[model samples]
Each structure stands twice: as C-alpha cells, then as structure tokens.
Target chain A: MTNRWIVLMVLLPLLTGVLSTPIVARLRLSRVLGVVGLSATLIAGLLLLNNATSEQAGGILVSQMGGWAAPYGISLVFDTFSGLMLCAAAAVTLCGYVAALGTLDRTVERRYFHPLMHFMLAGVNLSFLTGDLFNLFVAFEIMLMASYGLLCLAGGEAQLRQAYKYVLLNLLASALFVIAAGLVYGMFGTLNLADLMRIVRETSEQGEALPTGFTAVSVVLLTVFGLKAAIFPLWFWLPDAYPTMPVPLLAVFGGVLTKVGVYVIARTFPPIFAAGEAAEVIVPILLTAAALTMVLGAIMAVAYRRLRAVLCMFVIVGVGFALAGVAVGGETGLAGAAFYMTQSMIVAALSFLVCGQIENRVGSDDIDDAGQFSWYRAAPWLAVVGFVLAMTLVGLPPLSGFYGKLWVVQAAFTGPDETPGHSVWWLGLAGLVAGTITLLAALRWWTGVFWLGREDQTEEPPATQPASTGPRSLTLAVALLLAASLWMGVAAEPVLALAKDAGTNLADPQRYITAVLQPETTEPSYASTHGTTTPANDQAHRASPSTPEHHAQDSTPPATHADDRFGPNHPIRLRGGH
Target chain B: MTAVLAICVAVTFAVSVYLLLGRELKAVAMGVFLISHAANLSILAMSGSPILPTPDPELGITKRPPISDYDFDGALRHGDIAAPLDVMVDPLPQALILTAIVIGFAVMGFVLTLLVATSRKVQTLDVDELATGEKRHDPVERPAADGTVQGGAA
Candidate 1:
C-alpha cells in the first residue's frame, strides 16, 4: 500500500505533464487536473508521514522501476527526511497552485501553465525521493524545464531577462552537477547513492586513496550545490531573479528550490564528505559561510525598497540556518536546521503571499509607493496576517522561527569539545548578532510600510474602490500559510520530534545501508516477473573488494591536508577525503 | 596534451573577458558562449592527458610511464591521436558542457528577442531611455489626434 502511494506521488504529476499538451485547449480542465494531482500528492504525503512513525522501521522504501537492480537500473527511496520534505513541498505547491488558479490570465492559463506547475512539483518530489545521483540530475532537469515555461508564462521584457539569467545560472549548476556525477561514476562505476556511499566509506577506509581527480570533482559538485543554495557569494543572482516572477510562482519557488539544494548538501556531507578528520575542518568553513550569508542577507534586506526583494533576502537567511546546522555537525544541529528549514518554508510562502496582497491593495510593491496607501484601512486581514508573518521572519518568541534559531544556538554551543578552538563559536556569535539585526530590519520595514505615514502627501484614492478585492483564492492561501506558521510555532513538539528522528536517521548510516544492500530473500513477485533485480540488490552483489576500514585509513592524508588548509580546529574540513 | 587544452581554455577565457567587458549586447552574448567553451575545456584538461598509455588489456589497468619517457616527438604524436582515444576526456564534463552551451544559446535568443521587441516598442535600446519609460500605458497613447500628426517639428 505504501509503495502504491509512492508510485502515485511520482506518476500523477508526470501524467499531467504528458497530458498537458492535448489538454492545453481546455484551460479549466487543466486547472482542475493540476489541483487534483497536487491534492493527491498531499494525501500521499500525509499517508507517508503516518507510515514514518508507525513502528515499521521507516528506513528508505526502495522502489525499482522495472525490478532492475542497482549499478544499472533506476530506483526511488522514500526515507523519513525525504518524506517530510515531500510533504512540505506538496502542501506548499498545492497552495500555490490554487492561488495561481484565480490570478493567471486566461490566455496564459491556456498555455499549459497548470500542467507545467504540476510537472515541476513532480520533479521536486522525485528529486527528494530518488536514491540515485544521476536520477537526481534528471529530476532537476525536469524541474528546470518546467520552471522555464512558468518563468516566461507572461513573456514580458523584464520577465524574459530575469528568466534568462535564472535559466543560465541553473544551467551552469546543472552542468557542473553532471560533470561531478560523471566523475563519481567513472571512479566508482555506479550512480546509486547508497551504493556510492558504501563504496566511498569502504574506499576511504582502505589505504587505497581516492584520486585527486575525484576530490576536485567533489569540490565542483559542492560549488554547484552551493550556488543553488544561494550561500554567501553565490547569492547575488537570486534576489534579482526571484522577485521578477508573479507572486504565486515566487511563493512556490521560494518554498522549494534552494531547500532542495540544501537537502542534497545536508544528506551527502556527513556520510560522504565529512566522514573522517575532515569533519573537523569542513564544519568551520560552513559555519563561516552561514554567518556571512545571514549577515549579508539582513543588511541587503534593510537596503531593499521592494517588499518582494526584501523577502528574497530572507530566503538567504533560511540558507544560512541550514548551513549553520550542517556546520554544527551533530544531531542537535541537524535537527535544528531541519526544523528551521521547515519553518522557513512556511513563513516564506506566507510572506510572499502577503506581499502579493500588499501589491494588490496598494498597486505596487515599493515601500515608498505602498506607504502612501493605508493598508490597514484598505485590507485589515492582509495587514494583520502580514504583520504576523513579518514577526515570524524576525524570529519572535512563541513563533516557529524563534524555536528553530534557539535549537541552532543550543547545538552550536554544545558542539564537539575536541574542536574547541574552531571558529564555529565565532560564527555562532555572528549568527546571533545577525539574527538580531534581521529583527531590526524587519521591524524597520514594517514601520516604514505600515506604521509611518508618507511624508510626501499624495491624493488618496476613493475608499469605495475596494482595494482590488485581492482574489478570494489568494486570501485563502495566505490564511492557510499564516495558520500553518502559527501551528508550527505553537505545536512545535511533534514536528521537532519528527525532525529529531530524521536527524538521527541521517547520522546512523547502518539502517539506510542495510536496507539498500540486502534484498528480500523471498524474491518478490515484481522482481521475478519483471525479469530484473532491484538496483540495491545488484549493488550488494557487485560490491567492491575494499572495506570501510580501508577507506577510513586512506582518508587520513587528505584529512591532514584539509586541517592544514583550514586551521586544525576549523569546523569544516575542506580537503579531507571523506 | 593537457598543455594544449589548457592553452585553448586560457585563450577562450581571455576572449570571453574581453567581450564581456565590452558595451555592446552582442559582445556580451558572444562572451557567454566563449566562457562556456573555456569552462568545458578546463573540465577536459582536468581529466588529464589521453597520451598516457592505455590499460593492460587483461587487467584493464592503465600504466603511467616515467617523465623521461615523454619527449617532444612522443608528446606530439600522443597529443594528436591519443587526445581523442587514449583517454576518456571525462564524458561527464562533455555532456554537462553541451547542456550548458544549449542553455546559453536559448538564453541568448530570448534576450535578443527581448531587445528587439523593446527597441521596436520604445524606439531606443539605451538602458537610461528604457528605465525612464517603465510604466505600462494603453496602446492608444501611441499617436496624436490627427493619427499621423505628431509633435515632431522638422
């Protein structure tokens, strides 16, 4: 039953993508299909979450396409972390889809917008669930291709320019990803992530060192993923590109894209890259990056005149939180980061929706222009909801964002004692300062846009104009997100528990390794009938001769190299062979 | 062989930088293309030279000879043929570069279309001119009351 739902989650969106062309003539039907498809995904996610905590030993549930085994066939794995991410992604996409249904122009809607949106959601789901590296690449491509269509759905000059830059940057990242995957495959002769993890662990243990070529490849991969996550120096393009989209589209993009990159980095770093002495070196570097990203993002937010642009800056703050957690490099840090990310996604979506409402009411997103209008008088609900979300962004106590940050701070303080001299502590201090600065920045914007009256008096429009009515659908969407944010903050314990489970699962590789390595002896009906084995089974059979101990030994020299490059106590190990 | 690839990459990089810094839109587009090619070449170089001997047929193991074994004549011959066959040149990078190139072309085309459309509608390609007239107005504002009689005084 679980497998059936998993398959449905992937297939529904793909089916929508395929049927979109023929259905393009019928915009209403397409919209209905999109909503139904996403609704199904949301249902599947809920079911998966229930299954996750049902004492069923919720390791990754591997589903082979044609019963073909690893090193050859493709497979999808639904682990707890991925399941939770998918649930969030599905919920967010569903809301965005519904919100967009009322706002999209009929002409644009008929041009396959709904289907493309569903397909993109599908790609995101697949990317999260897949256990193979190459499959992850394919999922990204699918998502990117769909994004291209959505970005240009309105086809204006600004949209074209922004989308072009967005596509170009992502293309580079994707290229780098493929190059990295290729190098890994050429070296390891397999693309199954689980298989690669085992091989990497074993190879590092054996004194047979990974070639410098592969290490270079790893750096390239990290760079690409880093760009996607919009960490520090790589974040310049995002603020410009994201705000150019229509509100609902921006909401979904804000909720999902960067987080997917963060997910990949978080999932792979511990087991594959930071496995050895390098863990000591790599953690600090990540910590510094996180601190810089948070600080810079807040500073930029204070400078932005547009509400959407400011929210885009906050997306960088979310990235900082995720990186901070990874930099902290322990269970507490990971759980905090995961919980923070979940909270950010909800808050970001709500913020974007509120921005859309403001834009709708005031006829602009510019702080100066929006200030002329009385939003509180024009749309009281929007003003109230926006204020709540703004507080969430600033990490107010009793909000999910605050708890998330608290956890991260706690994790940082309690980090490994061996690396006492590491600068993670300094980075943590910077983050705390940055967090306070961000709160001030948010408050400043709120005051400017809502509280303070415009100095330059302009004739106010008649109150009877009704402030654009702000599509009932969009209001509903914003309310949904606002409620979720409140719920996440108030009912935080269960979600934190889930995040803790996910963090523990990530730290302990034994269950994941075993599930992927050992096939059921019963020779399941699907395997025999399809005339192929599961990818995991093939991986287990074609195991490398080297053991984990050998790889651990081989990782020593590079670990020293990394330690030398980044001080001995640096949290992050740059060149350590993991 | 790696040296030759490296030089090619360096030249591409230089040309890209030169074009990118130029004022014209076309030059920037061309620069993007050049930089993409340079990146692709760099990836190829990082894969190492194909001139190195192929693996022993039985064991599928390639052997690296002493530096003295590589003289100019051997280098030229290896650089010529081995560049293509002896080494794989990292097929992954090649595939990635190809995708990047295609995406670059698509973006360039879209930008060109935007430029053309904007120029036709606004009568100028200058950024200052474009920014000054950013507001969306009705199409009816295009002509005067007499249709052809505009404010132009020749």
Candidate 2:
C-alpha cells in the first residue's frame, strides 16, 4: 500500500483528542476514550512498524501532505527510526494508560488527562514524522503544552513548583527553536529536511562558501535540541522537573518524550550538515558534547537518592549513547544509535514503572530505605522482571541494549574513516564506563530494594502505600513491557537490520528527495488527487507568491525549491541579476 | 527597511534577555514573550526587502501587478522556464510567523497558568524564595554519598 495511510497514525490520536475533549469534559468518560485511543494508536503503531520493517518497503515510508510535492507542503516520513519510536511510544503510552487506571487520583482523572495524553501522543507522533521545520516547532509546542498541562494535572504545590521550571525552560527552548527555524528558512529559503539536504549538497558541490551566520544557525539548532535531550550542559532542568510528576506520567516523560529531541538531531545533523562546509567544526563540538553528557549521566546517577532522579540521569545516559552513535557517523554508529535509542525508550519507561512499583511495595524511592522489603517479601516475579530491565539498562548480554552498545563500540573502534576528527574512542569508552556505572547503580537499586529481609523494612511507610491496594495493572504493565523488551532482545538481529536500513537511508539524501518530491508517485494523476487545483497555470497562483501564507488555495502546489530563485546560490537580486 | 527591522530585533532580544535574567517570575515570563517576538522579527528581516521592479516608462505605476514576471498563472502549468523576478516580497515568512504566533500564544497561556498555579501554591512569586525540591529543606546532606540515603525535605 502507498505510504499515505501513515498519516492516520498522527490523525487518530489528534482528532480523537480534539473531538472528544469536550465530551470527556462533560461526561468524565476519559477512561473509555483514552483506552480506545491508546489501543488504536498502539495497533496502528505496530502496523506501521511492521510495514516499514517489511523488506519490500525497505523500511522507508513517505507521505506528502495536501498532495503537494515535498519542500512545499509539510511531509511526513516514517523510516525505521521513527517507525521504531512509534511502536515504543505506543507501548509506553499503553502501559502508562493501564497503570494510570490505578495510580491517578480522582483529581487527575477529572482533569483533561486522557485528552491531554492523546494530544501529547499526537505531538510526539507528528514530531517523529514531520519533515518540515515549522511543523516540528508546532509539534514541539503541542507536546510541551500537553506536558505542562499534564504536569499540573494533580495541582499539588510541589508539582506546580517543579512544573513552572519545566515549562519555563521548555518555553525558552521553543522560542529558540523558532529562531533557528527562521534563520534556516531565511538562509536557505526552504524548511523541508529533504530539500534542505538537496540544497546543502548542491551548494557545497559547487564549492560555494557558507554564509556568515551558517555555523551559528547550525549550533543554535543543536543547542535547542540539546536542551531538550538533556545533553551535558543543558541537562540540569531534567532531574528537577521530572521527579515531581506522578509515576505513570513520569514513565512516559522519561521514556519517550525526551528522545524526540534526540531523534530530530540524529535525523537532521548527519545528513544535512555533517558534510556541509562548516562540518569540520561541527563534528568535534558535537562529539565533545556527547562525551561529556555520557560521563555526567553516569556520575550523577550514583549521586541521586530518589528513584526517579536516578532514572532521569540514566535518561541522560541513553541520550549520550544515541548521540555517541551520531557523533561517530559511520553506518554502524548510526545504526547502533537507532537501535539503542529504540530500546532505551522501552527500557526507560518500563524501568520507571518498575521503580514506582518498588516504591509502592516498600516505603520510598531511596536506596537505603528500600533494603527492608525484598521481592521475596513484596513480589518475587516483579523482582525478576526489574532485574532483567536493569541488566538491559546496564547493557547486559542477550538483551537488546547489549547489541546496541556493541555496535556503538565497534563503530567507535574504527571511527568514521572519512573524517579524521571522529576517532571517538574515549567518547565511546565513556559510554561503556557509563554502562558499568549504570550496572553498579542498578545493583544498588536492586540490592537496596530486594536483597534484604523484612527486619530492615523500618522506614516510614510511603504515602501511596495505603492507597496502592495491590493494583494488578501496574504489575501487568511492567510485565508487558518486560515481555515486549524480551521479544526485542530475542529478535535483535532483525531490529538491528531495521536500524541499519534506516541509518543507510538517512545517510543518503537522494532517495529521500525522490520519495518526497517525485512528480509521479504510485500514480500519475497525483495532482488531481488534491481536487482543488484549477490547472497548474491558474493566474491565481501568481498572486500568492506576493502573499502565500494565506495562499491556501492551491491544494497541490509545486515544491518550494521549484523556483530556486531565492536560494543562496542563485539569490534573486532585487535590482535584477548583474 | 531590512536594516531597521534588524535593529529592532536586536534591541528586543537584548531587552528580553535582560528581563529573563530578573528575579521576578512575571518579568521572566514577559522576557520569554518578547524573545519569541524578536525571533519573529529576525525571520522577517532576514527574508529581505520586497524589491519592486522599475516602473515601465508608459505604465505610470510604482509597479505593475499584471506584468509578465509577476504573472504566476502561466508559470506552474506551462512549465514557464522564466527565471523568477524579485518584484514581490517573500510571503513565506509572514506565514511562518503567523503559525509561530498561534503556537506561541498557546504556550504562553500555558506558561502563565503554570506561573499562576505556582504562586498560588508557594504563596510568593519570588524565584529564590519559591524553594524547590527537598534540597532546600536540607542541602547539607542531600547529596549523601554512595547511592542510597535519605534526609528531611530532600
């Protein structure tokens, strides 16, 4: 089937939430709608993953919005990377939903929690799929808006306190994202990723020098994404904001939300700018950032007492691993990054779930206090599942994370031969050592939570313990995630191959352009598919260049670069070209 | 015109950053608002001036709208291989800023809500006195060495 159907993945959640918000508000039917929407998103996500991974499709799916060729209207491209994220997002959201049934208080439920969660999904799905910078900004806002709402859903003093910082930091980041998008659009006269790739390649091939602000723009974009990903210098906001969230929401926040930023950087950086004129400087800067982020996550993981705080630190570790792959820039590194990012999304969310579970059974998230209650005393099977996920986080063998780290290490060993600046050995070692620290931390978390007998359980009873009442859904959700992760581990080869396919495709831009801007895709009458065109030469189209923002009349306008008159190479000289 | 806008953008950005660094939450929120607008102005300035074509000697207008180069009607369909004329201003930036404006408004509303809720809860809008995390409760022993230890507030 044509990739047109992938739009459903975004629309289903968005439309459901948009349409049902009022109904849910009036009737309080959030549970029913949330379940239905989440289940459908999961089913669609799995289907997209299956479709993308299928060999015949080669794991690349592209859909141009409004039947307009790409580089003009927004486009949605779901390669193996995004497809994998979709599945992970769906699983995490589903788990969060199930767990929410037990964890959320009446206040949280009465608020627009369900609609907002779906809105968050919509934003996330769009960010993963959108091929336009403006669309990405919009998606970020949607997601951030939803997150701010959800963070304050319970309306506690502390939650609002932390939520303020979180919202402020993200709002700043959003403003910067716009500035970056504006700079890029103003510089290149195009916002589509594939088109940007094409323009960057064309200009560089002609030996054209980069414009003055080019590197600044690139760094700014990276900075914006870095702030989101919690990489090194910019990660201070994460631990502060994430811990105040209720557990189910925290699961989604740590698991899939932050990865969206990393995904954008990974998708854009290597392909569009890595080989561009300023790349000589860009590569080293990114490598240093990745390395420092890795070390910081590991060191801080050992320093934090709160379970959520430590896991948030590991979220940083996951960012480092994924970026380490991007920094290395080889096929193996990129593939490994993709694999590691996908696995971490699942493991991160599930790990948070397990931690919350342990907190419930025991008294607190602190390690010293957790020793009193063993899985032997609380729940033995949960202990087994937690151990497995923890080992996965530590990159233990036979789990999906191990293979991902292996690829990153192997790639780092050789480095990118094409570029001398990307040796990245110590950087990769940071990732490895970070994994070791993570193992030690996991041991601490496990030992502190499950190794000791009942005599040690003398800490004050946790606030939520009285209310938990042994809800089976939290257990079932963690187990389901564990089982999904186990399947991922067992099926590592296929997943790795899928990641490799995505990495190769990302490293190559021509295929992306063809997929996006091709005149005749699937059928020749695609223009008419828009049904609003009054012949391509309708004089009305001319008037809109003078005012195209409201130029919504043309349903299937030509790609933005079709003129190329305003592009850097052939800039439209105001007084006519000399 | 472009130069004037660039200056405006620079000034706005400076003022926004100044506001953002203030101790008052409301000032910081206003700073974020100004900075977002500054970006919009930067985008506008960078798209460059709307260079009108020299008026035809006999046509007697600043620029003729129905002129050949300005005509896009025949451009798309006939594959009119004509090079683009820089007669009209770029409208894309306007569109982008319009989108940004709406999204920004939504986020700004959210930020205000959070700020309001925070002040209501903490009983103050002062950044330092707001006191976040258990760290403020007991900063001395909060970073407790090794992996697992607890203290009041942190």
Candidate 3:
C-alpha cells in the first residue's frame, strides 16, 4: 500500500495540474483546486514520513516505478533524510499557496497561477523522491518550467528583464547538466546511483584504480548544483533574480528553492559520489566556498536597503551554514546541517510572509520608508510578529533557528568528538561571525521599522486604504506557520532525533543503496543481508544479463574509450553515429 | 569525426554567448534558442555518433537502420538500461535530447511572450532601460491630461 502511495506522492500534483487547468478556467475554481491539491500532498507526505521515520520501517522505504528495477528504471525512495525534506516542502507549498491567495490579484489568478504552482510542487517532490540521476534532471526541469512562468507572470519591465537573465543562466546550467549526465553515462554505463555503486564496488575489488574522469564528473555536477544553491562566485544571479518576484512567490523561492539545491548536494555527495577520488578535494573546496559565501552575504546584506534584499542575503547565509555541514562530512556535520536547513526553510519563509504583510500595510519594501508604518497604532500584531521572527532568525534561544545554529556551531568547534579536521575551526569561525552579523542586521531592520516611531506621527492619518486584511486564509496561513515554528522551537527533541537518524543514514550510503536497489521479498533483504560483501559479484549464477537483480554489468560500455570526450569508441563499420 | 562535432558545438555555443551579450531582448531570446540547440547537439555527439539532424530522425521513416534494443542489464551504460551492444548509434541520448529540445522550445516560447509583453507595456525592450520596481527609480516624467504617463504605453 505504501509502495503505490510513494509514486502517488510525486504524481498527484502533476496529475492535478494537468487535469484541472481547463476545469479551473471553466469553473473559476483555481483557488479551491490549488488549496485542495496541495493539502492532499501535505497529508500524503506526512503519512509517507511516518512510514519512513518509524523504527520498524528501518529508516528507508523505496518504490520501483513501472515494475522495473532501479538500475533498469526509475525508483522513488523515502528515507528519514528525504522524508524530512518532503515534509518541509509540503508545509512550505501549502503555506506559500495560502499566502499566494492573499497576494495574487484576480487578473493574475486567471492566468493559470494555481496550476503552475501545483506543477512546481510536483517537481519539488519528485526531485526529493527520485533515485535516478536522469529522473532528478527531469524533476529539475519540471520545477524550473513552472518557476519560469511564476517568476515572470507578474512581469514588470524590470521583472521580465531579470527573469530573462535568470532563464538564460538556468538554460546554460541545463546544458551543462545534460553534458554531465551524458559523460557519466558514457563512462559508467549507468545513471542509476545504486547500480553504479555495485559496478564501482566490483571493479575496485579486482584492485583496479578508480578513473580520474569520475572526479571531473563530480565537479561538473557540483558546479550545476552550486549555481542553484548560490555558493560564492556563482551566487550573484540569485540575489538579483529572486528578489524581484511577487512577495508570496518570493516567500517560497527565498525559502525553499535554494534549499532544494542543497538537498540534492546532500543526497548525491555521500550516496552517489562520496567514495570517488574527487571527494577528498571536493569537500574542502565546498567548505572554502561556504566560508566565502557567508562573508560575502553578511557584507552585502548591510549594503542593501530593501527588505527583500536583506532577507535574500540571509537566505545565502543559511545556505553557507548548511554547506558547512556538508564540508564536515561526518555524523555531526550531517545532523547539524539537516537541522539548520529545516529551521532556515521555515523561518526564512515566515520572514518573507510577514515582510509582505508589513510592506502592504506600509508604503514600501525599503527598510527606511517602510518604517513609516505606525505599528503601535496600525497593525500592532504584525509588528510583534515581525519582531519575534527577527529575534528567532538572529539565533535567540528558544526559537527554532537557535537550535540548528548551536549544533552547527558546536560541530565547527569540536569537529567530531574523535577527530577534528583543519576545516572545522574555519567553518566554526565563519558560522559564529555570520550568526552575529545576521542578528545585528535583522534586529536593526526590525527595530527601525517596528520599535522606532512611525514617520510623521503627528499627522495621524489612519490607513485610508481599504485594509490589507484580504482573507482569513492569509491570517490563518501566517498564524499556522508561526505556531509551527514556535512548536518546533519548544518541542525540539523528537525532530532533532529524527534529523540525527537521517544524518546517521547519510553516513552509511550502503544502507540507502540496498534499500533502493533490492527487490521485494518476504525475507529481510539481499543488500541488507549481503551488504558486507559484494553479493552481486558472488551470485552471478542466478542473475542474467538483464536480471532484475543486477544489470549484469560485466564490461565497461565500449563508448567511453573514444579518444575525445564527444566521440564514441569503435565507429560503426559503415554507419555508426546518430 | 570528433573534430567536426567538437568544432560545431564550440561554434554554436560561442556564437550564442555573443548574441546573449546584446542589449536587445530578441537577441537574448535568439541566444537562448541557439544555445539550447547547441546543448542538444552536444548531447547527441556524446551518445556515440548518431548523426540524426533532429530527434528521432528514424521515426515514421521506412528506410533506416533498425532501432537498438534495450537489455536493462546492470552492466549496461546510461541508467542501467542496456542498448544492444551491436547497434551502430545509441538512441538514448537522442531520446534525452529530444525531450530537452521540446522543453527548451516551451520555455523559449514563454520567454519570448514575456519579452514582447514587457516591451509593449513598458514601451521599451532595452534590458538596461527596465529596472523592476517603481519606487526604486524616480524618473520625473509628466502625465498627460488624461492621467496617463504621456505615452499611454500601459
């Protein structure tokens, strides 16, 4: 039952989008369908999370799509790690959708906005669930396709301009993705991570040296992910491209999109490419980039006057903290990074949501002019919400943000309890400095707007505008998210435990590989039972070339030996080459 | 043969980059289109010398080599789905590139429409001329008697 539901979790949004677009137009039920579709996704994801996270379920669940084995076809897996991401994504989508109902105008609503959003959620869910590399690429495309529409839908000349640039950058990234996938396929003869692991293991057993191209492949993949994750040097596009989006849309992109890139890095680094010769060099480079990113974000944040710009800078700082854990590359690093990501995803979205509300109540998004809103007289609760959110983001204790930072800061200082790497201290230093800067900037902005008196208080012209209170859905959504963040802060133990389990799972990729690649059976499992030895290598007698057990990989595909990167080996006698 | 394919990819991508640097939105759109096709071509080149001018060149055509068969053996390359080793050209990259092409076209269409709409609404297509957000800039243009901004572009 869970197996079938796993596929449905990824498919439901897409199906809803495809089926309901015309219906939404005819019935004008876009809002209703959007809310219903996303709520269902959230519930389904929670159920899946329960199954994946339970002690009896062994922390991993996988479903093979189309009855084909993973090395042969796509597989969707749910582990504590992916399960955590799914839950966060579901929450963000629902909240973002509700917030969107308040923000999007009636005209914009007519333009397939809800359907596009649903499609984007489907893509986000698929990206998390997919076990195949090509499928991951497909997932990225699905998300980007929807995002391209959403980003440009409210097209001012300025927004359309930035949207074009963003599209161009992503197009290049997509090209690079294809080239990387093609190369990986040519060399390894498989895009399935688990299958590749089996091939690598068996090949290494014969005492063969790992190919250097594998390292290059990893670097290419990282570069693509870096563009999305907004690491230093490649991050310039994000701050510009994302800040211009509509506030409701910004809340989601600001919070969740970059995290998706980080999530992919978290997934691919350990399970798929961790053992590669490149892992050693790559991890250090990642740490250096993370450190540089935090410094840059902290400095640039103060330079920006706009509310969203400063918030976007904080988003980068959060990314740096998460990547720090990736650099650490052990149990402590993984656990701390996961916690930091979940916290940032919620708090960042919350900040944007509150900021949008304030900006609407006030006149502008600029921190200076935005301070003109008399919070004491008008919208007192919003001011308080903003103050609390600011405090939470600054890492004040008893807030959700503080816990993640503590774990990450601790990891930075201690490294591992057993062995500390040279990079750990630097990571710690950057984390500490960034945390302080973030707190200072966020508090400064909050106080300037809320605590400080409104501009021209003597005039006392009440809000002449029709109240910013558009719908109960808006208030409901904001209150629900704020309460959820508070709940996470107050009751941190269970979630922390779950994050730690996910971290431990990441530390051991073999467990994930076995759970994904193994076939269904009454017994415990093949990968789990024979996980210690290269069981597939020993059980050659039972498996055929196309066996569901193994993709009977005896030889490296002959294509990679082509003298040039693009050329395939052994040109067909008379007709070889598509 | 590798030389020919490599040169073509490099030239296509290089030209696209040059076009992308232009101030005009149309050029930007063209740059995206050319670059995407370049990417599609490079993918085909990597897939073992399939010289089809377009995706599925063999589809609906009679006089062509037989399509390759998949074995799905773990030993096979590219997603563990094995194409017959004896096949002249691998069809998988073609399939992948075809998908990329269709996706690219859809995205390109959307971008072009956005470009036109923004130009029509803002009365300019110059990238530098349009810096989003009304409050960010303070251009002192006088309004017409009808309360339109002189030109009635919006």
Better of 1 and 2 by DockQ: 2
Best by TM-score: 2
TM-score of chain B of each: 0.54, 0.61, 0.61
What is the overall TM-score of model 1 with all chains considered together? 0.79
Residue A23 Cα positional deviation in candidate 1, in Å, after optimal superposition: 2.4
Residue pairs with colliding backbones in model 2 are A372-A456, A372-A457, A537-B73, A539-B73, B134-B153
Off by over 4 Å in 3: A26-28, A198-207, A421-423, A454-456, A466-470, A522-578, B48-85, B131-154
C-alpha positional error of residue A36 in candidate 3 after TM-score superposition, expressed in Å: 1.7
> In candidate 3, residue A189 scores what lDDT?
48
Interface RMSD after interface superposition, each candidate: 11.8, 7.0, 9.1
lDDT of 1 by residue, A461-569 (tens): 6565445747888888887888888999999888888888777767666566666655454545454568765443344334533356534644454322221222211
For all candidates, state DockQ relative to the true structure: 0.10, 0.25, 0.20
lDDT of 2 at A22: 82
For residue B46, give model 2's deviation from the true position in Å: 1.1
lDDT of 2 at B122: 64
What DockQ does model 2 achieve? 0.25
In terms of lDDT, which candidate is strongest? Answer: 2
Docking level for model 1: incorrect
Error (Å) of candidate 3 at residue B130 is 3.3
Runs with alpha carbons beyond 4 Å of true place in candidate 2 = A25-28, A54-56, A417-422, A452-469, A522-578, B49-86, B132-154
